[model samples]
Target: MEPIRAAIVGTGNIARIHADSLRGLGDGVRLVGAVDVDVDRLSAFCDRYDVPARHPDLTSLLEKEQPDLVHICTPPGTHHDLALACLEAGSNVLVEKPPALSLAEFDNLIEAERKHGAALATVFQHRFGTGAIRLRAMLDSGVLGRPLLAICHTTWFRNQAYFDVEWRGRWDTEGGGPTMGHGIHQMDLLCAILGDWTEVSAVARQQARRMDTEDLSMAHVSFAGGAAASVVNSMLSIREESYLRFDFERATVELTHLYGYGDDDWRITPAPEFADEVMGAWHSGASGVRSAHRAQFAEVLRSLRTGTPAPVTSTESRRTMQLVAGVYASAFTRSAVRPDELSTDSPFYRKMEGNGPRW
Candidate 1:
């Protein structure tokens, strides 16, 4: 098969992940071109990656190299426009998380994807990790039985200096703090595991960070499958951890890691009556893969090759992003918000801040 012609849009830290992941895929993918507004950074990135061409913006890169896929690693605020442009040009796009600034923006991109012949996918790498894959399989197979309760916590510290990067923490740019920028990874995985959510009642606080957005958010989410999850997204913790716990009728599963997790990070405890079978299944579950950009990029390639939509399709991601926006909407409105309430007429659908944050 011919290598996939790929391009990176940003030269910042996350873009490095995209570039490296693309390189790791070997002959199946090619780093055809790259783009960045900053000339020096772009040149340095292209030079380091040995990219064939570099352009000032997406338009130039699209017009020249005509990459088969464009990875938008730019700021959350810029994702919609860049992704829209790529899709409009008949190029598939795999954009970084928070795929858009708001549900409105996300929906627009969805429309563009349907209108154009190209595809659009969101980056929710945690869902692709082998551990998550195995767990989902078990749940689907009824080995774990029905999910009862779960906890999804992404507690990591980012000092004030980290937010000084101009686009780091703001309602308009970063899109609403830890819940959007940092914890969305774990949260997306949570949604992927539990399926659709029914309602959300959340509270957000500015906490320790001095920014235009909250540094912490807490919420209770009820899922359609009769499961409830307690979620917390915070950047104020000193001893940071990304933790998730799921309790099933037969067993309890837990994963603990700061960012990406491997098989060793997962633990399962089975109810006495079902202990033998559950442990045997857990022991035989898939292993030897860590959750990261490369793990997901491989899946993206497979889907493209098979002529199917990529993993974490926009519809799947919209639910996760709905939970994010729900957190903001519920916190600001001081009421429980349902997924249906985030419709066209809803303020939260129009903007994540939803008529600005409560504070």
Candidate 2:
């Protein structure tokens, strides 16, 4: 089979991960081209990745390579337009998280995908991890019993200097703070495991940061599956950790890791009566894969090969994005936000801040 041709836009820090992950796929995919507005960075990235073609912009790259996939590693502000360009050109897109500045922008890309017969996938790598896979399997098979309560936290530090960059902290640029940007990864995984969320009530604070968006956000989310969760996305923690605890009727499954997790990062404690069944199910779960760009990329390539939508499909990611918007809506409005309320007519759908961030 011919290897799928892939290209990347935005030669920044995260773009390197996309390049490396694509390269790591070896014979399954080819790094055919690259694009960046910055000449120096483009030159460096292409040279480092040994990309065969380099273009000044998306149009040129699409016209030249016509890559099977384009990874949008640009900032949240540019994700919508760039991914739209790829989808319009009949190229699949694997975009970085917070996929768009608003649900409005994301739905635009979704519409373009339908119109163009292309796929739009968000880079929610955490969902592809072995532990997450195992847990979901058990949940589906009733091995884990009913999911009752949960906690998802992304607590990592970002000092004031981190937001000093021109686009780092603005609503129009980076969207909201930790909730939409940093913590969305874990939140995506949470959604993956718990299924669709129904409502969110939350609070956000600019806290210690001087940015226009919140530095800390806390939300209580209710899932349609009769499960409720407490979520915390913060850039204010000194001791960083990404922790999620899912308390099922039969067991409590906890995942503790910083950025990614190996199987060892997960721990399960089963109720005494269901001990054997829960332990057996957990032991038979997915293994040997860490949650990373590579793990998710492998699945993405497999889907493309099979002529199917990729792992983190537009629908799934949009639901997760809506959850992010829900957090912001609940915070800014001082009211609970539900999935149905975030429509095209809703201000929160057009901008995460709704009217504006209260802070």
Candidate 3:
């Protein structure tokens, strides 16, 4: 099979992950070009990665390089426009998490994808880990019975300097606090495994930062399966720990990636009562972050090759964005917000609203 040519946008922190994944794709993929408005950053990225061409903007990149895929590594707020542009250019797109600022923007991207007949997907590579895949499979197969409750405890250390970037803390730029920005992976995993949430009540704070948005957030979500969940996400902390624990009717499953991004580091434990059920479905040993990213990239390439379906479709991404908007609205109103209950009048439903709540 011919290599899938890829152009990347944004030369920031996470762009390295995309570049590394492309390099690891061997002949399955090639890094065709990179685009960024910041010429200095764009030049630095191309030189560092030895990419052939660096375009001043997406329009030029799409016209000149004409990559088969556009990997959007830009911030959440830029996803809708960039994705639409890529789809219009007849290139498939793989955008980073929190697909867009709101469910509406996400819907716009979805429409654009459909109109262009392009494959548009959200990047939630964390869900591709061995541990996560096993857990999802077990749950899907009813080996663990029905999940009763879930706890996603994700805490990390990011000081003020981390938000010192020009657009880090603003809702217009980066979206919400940890819940929308940092903990989105866990949220994605939660939705992937447990299904859509019915409603949510949340509280948010900016206790440790000078940013315009909250640095901490807590939400209680009720899933459609009658399984309740509590999510605690924050960047204000000393020791960092990222964990996902699910309690099922037959057994309890837990996986933790607190140490950072890697598969061998996860721990999966099942309840003693359901030992047989869990053991029968046991599967572990993931390659690592690079491998997971590569796995998703390969899936995207396959979708483009066969004109089939991408693993994480635009509709799925819109659901994720809806959940994100629900979290932000829950925190904003100090009330419960339903997953499908966004009003046209809701501020979160409105596009380009100002920065989220402040401390």
TM-score of each model, paired residue for residue: 0.99, 0.99, 0.92
Let me know the TM-score candidate 1 reaches against the reference structure.
0.99
lDDT by residue for model 2 (51-134), tens? 989899999999989999999988888998999999999999999988899989988998999999999999999988899999
| lDDT (10s digit) by residue, model 3, range 75-148 | 87798899999999999889887778776677778888889888889888767666676677777787888888
Model 1 ranges with Cα > 4 A deviation: none
Model 2 residue 231 CA deviation in Å: 0.5
State each model's CA lDDT, in order.
Answer: 0.92, 0.93, 0.79
Best by lDDT: 2
Can you give the lDDT of residue 51 in candidate 2?
Answer: 92
Please write out the lDDT profile of model 1 over residues 1-359, one tens digit for every residue: 89889999988999999989988989999999988999999999989999989899889999998989999999999999999999999999999988998999999999999999888999999988889999999999899999999999999999999999898898888788999998999999999999999999999998888999999999999999999999999998999999999999999999999978999999899999999999988888888889999999999999888999888798999999999999999999999999999999999998888998877
RMSD of each: 0.8, 0.8, 2.5
TM-score of 3: 0.92
Worst 10 residues of 2 by lDDT: 280-289
